[model samples]
Target: MGLGGTAKKIQTLAEKAEQTYQRLNDLREEVEKTQETVTETGDRVRQLETEMAEQRAVLDAVAEEVGVDLEAVSTDAHITEAESDDEADDAGDDGSADTDGDDEAVDDDS
Candidate 1:
């Protein structure tokens, strides 16, 4: 009787240990997947940041080509510029663009 009770206790202990090992493996897999996702997300964010910086550079270049201060392109400037454009359109004016002809002349001289 004593040997049978001891065998049952050992079997129960083995089952619990197996369950614990499976749980650990499951946790390890979850952690690995989480780490991979974090790495991919980090890479994507850096790519987006680089793209945004490039777009900002292009926007700045366009602003310079129009002879306007890119630094001053705030929300207020956007609103005012929009209104000014509407007025110009309504008045049928085409000669009030922000570009300076003298700047081109100076560039030609250089």
Candidate 2:
């Protein structure tokens, strides 16, 4: 090949290298932004968890003062929720038949 051809190849390679460098910088910026977002979300979750614990403590104290069996009430509430969910699932199942297992197998195959 001539010197001109060699120079052209080198120029092409340099252009590709520059494009790759820009993409890498862009990806780094995106990763840093995502990390900042994740950190903020984690802090918010912790704050919400603390608030929930405080609220639960106050509710437990109030229930005690009112002579309500908080533990029993909580158990009953869970049972009722489970029963309701079961009923809903059963109701929704009327049209589907026994296809859930088959669907899962098909998904696994895919």
Candidate 3:
């Protein structure tokens, strides 16, 4: 009777140990999945940051190429060349020249 009782206790302990091991393995898998998610998220964030920086560089380059003063752009608006010339010509009603510095040669000798 004593030997049978001891064998039954051993069997129960073994079963409990197996259950604990399985739970530990499950926890390890969950931790690995979480780490992978974090890594992927980090990589995506870094990629976005790099792309933003590149876009900024391209914007700066384009602004320079087009002779845009970024600082003055917010405060001032400019008319097109044709509109400006027409306005200047209209303002110069006397047959002299436009005040915007586009002076035509007049026949002063006449």
Q: In candidate 1, what are the lDDT values of residues 1-110, reduced to their tens digit?
A: 99999999999999999999999999999999999999999999999999999998998889889898665668778899999998986676343543674545544553
Question: Cα lDDT of all candidates, in order?
Answer: 0.85, 0.89, 0.82
Regions of model 1 farther than 4 Å from truth: 75-110
Backbone clashes in candidate 2 total: 0
TM-score of each model, paired residue for residue: 0.64, 0.82, 0.54
Deviation (Å) of 76 in candidate 2:
1.5
> Which residue ranges in model 2 land beyond 4 Å of their true spot?
98-110
- Residue 63 of model 1 has an lDDT of 86
Candidates sorted on TM-score, descending: 2, 1, 3
RMSD of model 2, in Å? 5.2
Error of 1 at 79 (Å): 11
**Candidate with better TM-score, 1 vs 2:** 2
Residue 88 in model 2: lDDT: 95
- What TM value does model 3 have? 0.54
